[model samples]
Target chain A: MLTPLKEFATDIRIQQMEEFKARGFGHVGGSLSITDCLAALYGGIMRIDPKNPNWEDRDRLVVSKGHSGPALYAALALKGYFPLETLKTLNQNGTTLPSHCDRNLTPGVDMTTGSLGQGASTACGMALGLKLSGKDSRVYLILGDGECQEGQVWEMALFAAQHKLGNFIAFLDYNKRQLDGYVTDICDLEDPAAKFESFNWYVKRIKGDDPDKIYETILETQKNQKDRPAMIVLDTVKGGGVKQIEDTTLNHHLNMTTELADEIIKQLIKQKEG
Target chain B: MFKCIYNGEKETKAGKTVFGETIRKMIEEDPQVVYLDADLMNSIGTSGLEKSFPNQVIEVGIQEANMAGLSGGLSAVGKKPFMHTFASFAGRRCYDQVFISIAYAKNNVRVIGSDPGITSAYNGGTHMPFEDICLYRAIPHSTVIEFTDSAMTAALLPVIKERPGLTYCRLSRKNCIAIYSEDSVFEPGVANILRDGKDAVIFACGYMVSESLKAAETLEKEGISTAVVDMFTIKPLDTAKVLEFAEKTGAVVTAENGNVVGGLGAAVAGFLSETRPTPVIRVGVKDEFGQVGTPEYLAGVYGLTPADVVAAVKKSISLKK
Candidate 1:
């Protein structure tokens, strides 16, 4: 039986497929891999006002793995941040939706992120600012496993720990694949949970595709009394949920022909109806 | 119409102290103002600020790029962030963060890069940055300024704080010759004509402004009149003031404590070649690296004294037809 949040995730995944099919090319593997976590965040976990996207006390979400913008946009649209019909305009001329997340163009985007490791540092600043101002707002950040190769990520990890940013919670989308190839073949980040734990972040490794587990973990982490930041290493598969693309080894980005896109959309619609 | 009044003292106040005092005052006045440094609070004299406003001042130990992204993040949430670090690390070590996180994202951040150019004397070539101005000038909508002295540093702080977008402030940590009075007023993108003459005009910025003034006095003794313009703001270039002075003097000399290739010299020459074709001679480091030495020893070694400026002025005058 699908929980309400899992059903929401499935609808978002279908919308993401429709978006990529309309565009004919998009980052498919990584985008699909993180959809459930995005659904959990937008649906139940984050304290946000869809009508007032820039609410001062709203919990902030910065998708540091910004290439997964398609999934994020679907979640935002389904949450009524903007009209769901606008998702078809992804990457088109004069479209507000670009390939990567842009805070200026997107209504619900908290931080503009595309360059691998920059969003993590920005999230730290936001958390620090909120804490200094005596605001109870929390900040959530998402990062990719391959994005951890950037030295700036470690630099931010050190900073976040030293400052005791308890209001900051980061999710590492451990999708195991990058633009080049498998993460282990390129630059393995084995024991990522231990790596973050060594940096003084309270680490929680969870199955990313399970909406109930993601929501419960976020709640439990937020309840902890630790005076340090938290990191949830989400064990996800690249191109998860869909079997055909998930089986492909190098499905980071896809050049979707008419036939391939139609087949994916058919599967998505059937799953949605079921 | 700003005038420069030399106080005749070799030192008035250190730029870092003035920056520290001004930033401390800003933090006290505005709750929205936050300070970040790469563990150089003592180096830049901002340790006192950390003591008083512990929550507002963040000392990210030895992390320049992370500090920049942190500034961007703070700016995203409507907090005005001021970051300080050495020029070399601030520019070269964290150029990408300043480019994407701050400038490209259109977030407001004020970066203070202390000990610019030859002012990093005892710190050696590893710490000196001659290419900072070149790197910062490439960012669109970035306001880049080189502080001439303590007075200018104090005057420009509030102005830069209120302005939006990315602002880079290049200042020296130590004291230099005082060029402006304590009450001297300044406007962004406006060059100060310290002295007016007809023979030629010398465009100078940062530590080179004092050298230009001394060179003007030397030329006056030799019966050759010269005009001196303090071109403090580098990016916007103050092309109108440059063109007006270049047209009036008919010859130009650019003096800077940085490289002649892409510093103030290149900016002035590039503008003049397009607007007014004037004979411009650049008096600065001639495509070389820095070494550990005293300020005096380094000035002489790099030909950055008033004699070099005077020689360049005379040569430019001779080249003018």
Candidate 2:
């Protein structure tokens, strides 16, 4: 049985696929993999006002793995940040929805992020700024497992730990695949959780496909009294929620035709109806 | 209208001292101003910030890139962040972060890159940055500035804080020959004419401003009346002032402590060639790396002495039609 949030996530995935189909090509694999987390964050967890996206006290969500912007845009559109029809203009000329997240162009984007590993450091900055201003607003960052290979990520990790940024929470979308190949084959981040643990972050691992588990873990991490930044390693498949592309090895970015996209959308609609 | 007083150097102060004092005052006045350093608190004279404003000062240890990104994040949330480090690390080491995180995101970050160019004496080429200005000038909407002296550093600190965009402040950490009075007002993108002469004009920034003044004094003894303009703001180059001076003098010499290939000399030459043609001579370091030595030794070795500027001035005059 699908939970209410899970059903919402399915709707987001459907929209994301439709947008990609309209564009003809996009980062379909990573985008689909992160939909459940985005659903949970936008649906329930993050304290954001879609109407007044620049509310000073609202919590911030910086998607560090910004190639997955299609999924993030779907969530933002579905939540009324913009009209749902705008999703069709994903990568069209003069479209506000670029392949990566641009804060100035996008209505609800907190920070512009396309370059990998930079968003992590910026998230730490936001958290630090919030704490310095005596605001209790939290900051959430979503990073790719492959994005962790950048040295700046570790630099931010050390800074976040040293500052004891209790309000900063990061989610590593460990989809196990990158643009080139599987992360293990390219450069394995063996014992990824251990790395964050050593950096003094409160670490947790969960199945990313489950909205309930993600929600519960975030609540539990927030309740902890320890004054340290938190990291939740999301164990997710590369093309999660859809079985066809989930098993494909080289689906990091899809060169999809309209036929393939239509087939994926059909399956998603059937799953939602069932 | 600015006067260069040589004999009575009464108001001279170290660049780091003025920087520290000015930042301290700004922090005390504005609750939104925050300071971050890459473990160079004592080196850059901002060590007291940690003690006074504990929450506002962050010492991100030995991580320049992270410091820049963090500054961007703070700016996003309405905190005016001022970050300081050596010039090389501030420009070359963290160029990407400064580009995407700060400039591209449209966040207001004031980066203070102390000990620019040959001023990184004893630290050698490993710490020296001859291309800092060139790197910053390429970024669209970036305001690149090099402080002429302690007074200029003190005057521009608050102005840069309020400016809404990416700003790079290049200043020496040690004492500088003070050029302006304590109350001298400064506006960005405006050049200040220190000395006026019809024979030749000298454009200089950072430590070279003092050198150019000394060269002017030497040229005056030889009956060669020279003009000196403190071209502090490098990007958004004061094209009007540059063209006016070039038209007035008919000959130009650019002196800097950085590489002539892309530093002040290149900027002036490129601008002049496009709009107004003039006989221009560049007096700065040739294509070479810095070496471990005293500032005086390195200045002489790199052909950055007052005598070199005097020679370049003569050459520019001779080339004039």
**Model 2 misplaced regions, further than 4 Å:** B1-3, B8-12
Please, what is the whole-model Cα lDDT of each candidate in the order they appear?
0.90, 0.90
Model 1: per-residue Cα lDDT over A66-135, one tens digit each: 8999999999999999998899999999887888999899889998899999999999999999998999
Give me the chain B TM-score of candidate 1.
0.98
DockQ-based class of model 1: high
- Assess the local accuracy of residue A207 in candidate 1 as a C-alpha lDDT between 0 and 100: 90
TM-score of each: 0.97, 0.98
Candidate 1 Cα outliers beyond 4 Å, as residue runs: B1-3
Give a tens-digit lDDT track for model 2, residues B22-76: 9999999999999999989999878878977988888889999999999999999
lDDT of 2 at A96: 84
- DockQ, all candidates in order: 0.82, 0.89
